[model samples]
Target: MIKVIIFDLDNTLYNEKEYVISGFKAVALFLAREKSLDYCTVYSSLLESFVINERGKNFNYLCNKLNIDKSIIRRLVDVYREHYPEISLKEDIEMFLLELSRKYKLCLLTNGWLLPQKMKVESLRLDRYFDTIYYSQQDGLDLAKPHPKYFMKILQFYKIEASEALMIGDDPVADIQGAKDLNIPYFQISNELDDNEKQKIMQFLHNNI
Candidate 1:
């Protein structure tokens, strides 16, 4: 019997697009304030340099690409920390996560850094529910998600059989298929996917579940 459910943080537990928009606006606002650039221009350049360059997960690359001056990145990170504490369970999530916790040994398996994720979780007070939160950076860059090793580490660390646990998350390539490859039950949360995208998530969940 499945006894554990591991949830991915960020969009998986909330409306994901809103989080992206807010983060973008935060970065854009900071850039505009410090560099005297228009919000749109800074947001655009940010998209190109970070997303297009596929450095979305790399903060150092973002620091360089944004021309972040001394202490700017730290300050902006602090800004994120300030705003993040206010972002809590979206829509049905708080209840859902709570309900799941009652029936299962629920954990959080996320693919982000410590500061931002920590602030968000702390602010949400979700620590009261989930038994554990495995931050990927705790294992270093090479062990991050989509690499297979990371997911396996979590499963082994918890002494969970792949068949005895479920992975619920947002990312398509990372959370979905990574857990799938390990023969675990996988569910994609359709927090912000469009109709077509929702169908894709449904299909994956339907097939896997």
Candidate 2:
């Protein structure tokens, strides 16, 4: 039986692309003011880079394309990370959490930079739903998901065995693999869940939890 439910933050409860877009808008505005460039163009370039899976190099891509100083890349990153993201959970997700919180212990396990993750939790008001929220970066990136230690930490905190917890997340590697390594049961879902997927998750809970 599942006594605790562990959730990944990005692309699980809410769409991670929304957060990326929101951060891009914030950085674009900041860059536009500092470099006298058009905000639309800057934002578009950032989005395009992201769409192409630029990964950690979006700022560099934008700077090289726009002839902006490379020295400012760090500042742009800071702006993106520090910005208060304009994001919200979907109504269905909100209701799902409300319902789940009433029944089982809910915990959030996410891997990301500390401040941005904290902002996301604050923005979504995840505190209302989750009994505990673990940011893996607090323990260092090496301790992030796919490493069994953080997962073990969560289990230890709740004083529950791995078999008693359910991991839900979008990433096949970080979230699912981590749970798998510890023999924790998991339900894989997409970043954005449609009606059918939501129903399937509910069915899984009913049958398993």
Candidate 3:
């Protein structure tokens, strides 16, 4: 039985589309006003650079290299924090979580800056739902997800075996594969995969996982 279910925050818990629309609009507006750069160019280039670097939402590094003022990124992040609380939860998530809480402990294991994620939790009123929340930055740990140490740390901290836990999220490689690496089973919750890829993932999850 899965005693604990570890969840990812952004794009996993809430609707990814809402975050994209709000986050992009804020970034574009901030760039146009402060940097005098083309709104589209800055937004496009920032996303491209972020994808290339594989550092999702780590804007401090991007700010230092882009010659753009860190203030702009910080400002947008603040806007996101303010607006993100208004973001609605996905279908059945609220009810599903309520149902799950009665059976098993719910824990959140996410990697992000302190303010935005904290604001998100507050805005969504998620504190009452989870037994615990483990944030990479807030905890003063560099152990982000996809790193085996991150999963190991949670397991050790909770005093639960890998088999007793289930990691659920939308990201396949990061959350699914990462959990698998540490003998913790995972379930994919989004429909972002093609049929073939989905089948492969299905087998991977059950076979020796």
Candidate 4:
């Protein structure tokens, strides 16, 4: 009797790697232009830096490696965070969401900064499909996933019991364990978006609901 479906937006609905690559390209282009370096070289450097350094400190690593002024790192960081990303759901996902919306109330729950997450939803036109959306930063409760209260707030809002809701997501801790903490059902998958995964979800809904 799953009446509601909660989706983790980033790696669940769409491939988060795509968003990261888009941001990298933006940063690469900016660096190439400013430093008179080849765009491809800058892009490769940024990618390598991303893998080795903490995400927030990637710009510092890039600046140190490229001998670029540290002052400009702030601007680069802003570009990486604020750049408009090219993102969209796959055809299978679009159709699945359309079908799911008809049968179950769908809510998007994600952890991230408020504005950027909203922008991602807007860019992909996902805002229309969800009944309600929750962002960790915007919820005013400072609640983050893996915390029971985070899921509790949503249940309270919809007036639904934990047994009546299902969470589908890619993160074990943030999405799956959080729901499990309350005896809610959940399905976890690898953070890649693929037709096989979408089909599995559709099948799960059919069998379980």
lDDT of 1 by residue, 40-112 (tens): 9766665666555553443455557666554666766565545564455654556556666776788887776
Question: Which segments of candidate 4 are over 4 A away from where they belong?
Answer: 32-38, 51-57, 139-142
lDDT of 4: 0.83
Q: Over the full model, what C-alpha lDDT does candidate 2 score relative to the true structure?
A: 0.91
Model 4 per-residue lDDT tens digits across residues 50-121? 787736777777778778779987898788788888888888788888888999999999887777788898
In order of TM-score, best first, we have 2, 4, 1, 3
For every model shown, what is its TM-score relative to the native structure? Answer: 0.65, 0.93, 0.64, 0.86
Error of 2 at 91 (Å): 0.8
* Global local distance difference test of model 1: 0.69
Best by TM-score: 2
Q: Cα lDDT of all candidates, in order?
A: 0.69, 0.91, 0.68, 0.83
Candidate 3 C-alpha lDDT tens digits along 90-123: 5466766676677678898777677767767876
Q: Mind giving the per-residue lDDT tens digits that candidate 2 earns over 88-190?
A: 9999989889998999999999999999999999999999999999999998999999898889998999999999999999899999999999999997887
Best by lDDT: 2
Model 4: colliding residue pairs = none
